[model samples]
Target: MLSIRNLHASVDGTPILRGIDLEVKAGEVHAIMGPNGSGKSTFANVLAGREQCRVTQGEVHFQGHDLLAMSPEDRARAGVFLAFQYPVEIPGVSNIYFLKAALNAIRKYHGLEELDAMDFISRVKSKVEMVKMDEALIYRAVNEGFSGGEKKRNEILQMMVLEPALAILDETDSGLDIDALKTVADGVNQLRSDDRAFIVVTHYQRLLNYILPDHVHVLSNGRIVKSGGPELALELEERGYVWLNELTAGAA
Candidate 1:
């Protein structure tokens, strides 16, 4: 569903993603693992068309269209979703209102009619149940005053409701207990299908236990140095990125 080639990006004129390449086909999950400052998050933001992380060179085509040329909003309408590493709080906007607006906007873009209020609420509540989130929280402001787990679940809830063709999760497992992690992973697992794909960017391997990816890639110094099957993640857990220094240096 997504193809990236020799993708290079920079922020504030400082290079981050030096050279990257990957392919995410439908019905597949690809996990991106790396140490800190390896541009893992930068790669995610660039795919979501974050203006600050400028794509200085190369091309990204999503569903056969030029991805980098699209605006961030256009990316969303085209079925690209990015669950932020740090979800921001929109203090005054109720979660339900925000979600409804977002879903309807995507629907409108695809020439589908917007759901009525009752229908929207019912659908969201069902997803809330799937994520094991309190229905009451949906009426509160978006991510405002939520616990770390709640915020993460909220991100999963958004993903469930949108059903994006490509979901880019940047460190969704960063600050969760085992239970919360499993819940979040379950929500993602439930969304897997023949027509959708996921890009899971994480620093740890535990999350992979539940949301087992079809491919595991290691990013270092802003480039993907090595990629292998699911066993690669387990190898990373046991060996750590320290052993990958030579690979990174060789790439440089």
Candidate 2:
């Protein structure tokens, strides 16, 4: 569903992603694990078309379209979703209103009719239940007073409702307790289908235990040092990124 080749990105002319080449096929969940300053979040931001992180080199194609050439809105309309590690608070906008506007925008982009209020509410209520979110919270302003877990769950709720083709979750598991983590993971698991893909970026392997990625990649110095199956995550948890450092050094 997504193809990234020799992707290089920079912020203020300082490089973050040097050469990231990844192919995310439909229905595949790829976990990107790395230590601090390894460019995990930068890579996610780049994919999401954040303005500060400029693409210095390479190509990204989503569903055979030039993803880098598209604006952030175009990317989202094309079915690309990025769940930020820190979901921001929009004080004035009610959660339900924000969601409806976003969903309608994407639908409008694809020549589909917008969901009426009743239909949208019904659809959102089901997804809110799937994420185990409090129904009352949806009527309040978006993330204005939500707890850490609630904010994270809110991101998943957005993902579930949008039903994006490729979801880039940037440390969605960060700062979540085990219970909250399981709820979020369950929401993602429920959304998994034959044509959906996920790029899960995380610092530790604990999240992977629940989400169970099909592939695990280790990032060091902004490059993928090694990749393996799910077992690699366990190995990283046990051995840490020290071994991966050697692997990257060897490649250098």
Candidate 3:
């Protein structure tokens, strides 16, 4: 569903992603593991078309169209969803209103009629039940004063509501306890399907236990250095990233 080749990006004139090549097909989940400063988040931002991260060279095709050419809003409308590591709070906007507007916007982009209030509420409530989210939270301001777990669940709720084709979760496991982690992972797992894909970027392997990625990739120094199957995550857990760096150095 997504193809990236020799993708290079920079922020504030400082290079981060040197060259990234990845292909995500439908019905697959890929886990990107890396140490700090390895440009994992940068890669996700670039894919989402965040303006601060400029792509210097490369091409990204989403469903056969030029993905990098689209604006951030357009990308979101085109089914690219990024769940931020730290979800921001929009103090005054209730979550229900914000998500309804976003869902309607995407629907409108796809030439579908907007859901009226009653239908929209019914649809969102169903998803909330699926994710086991508290209905009360929907009436509150977006992410405002929510706990870390609540915020993460809120992100998944957004994903469930939008039903994006490609979901890039940037450290969604961060700051989550085991139960919270499982809850978030369960939400993601429930969304998996033959027509959707996931790119899970995380530092620890614990989250992989729940999400069960089909592929595991080690990213270092802005490039993906190794790719393997699910066992790769367990290997990384037993032997840290230093081992991968050493192996890369020896190979070089």
Error in Å for residue 98 of model 2: 0.6
lDDT (10s digit) by residue, model 1, range 148-200: 89999999999999999999999999989998899989988999999999999
What is the descending TM-score order?
A: 1, 2, 3
lDDT of each: 0.95, 0.94, 0.92
lDDT of 3: 0.92
Query: Which portions of model 2 show Cα errors greater than 4 Å?
Result: none
- lDDT by residue for model 2 over 120-200, one digit each (tens)? 999999999889899999999999999999999999999999999999999999999999899878977988888999999
Point out the higher-scoring one by lDDT: 1 or 3: 1
- Where does candidate 1 stray beyond 4 Å? none
Candidate 3 regions with alpha-carbon error over 4 angstroms: 250-252
Q: How many clashing pairs in candidate 1?
A: 0
TM match of model 1 to true structure: 0.99
> 2 or 3, which is superior by lDDT?
2
lDDT of 3 by residue, 30-84 (tens): 9999998989999988988888999999999999889998989999999999999
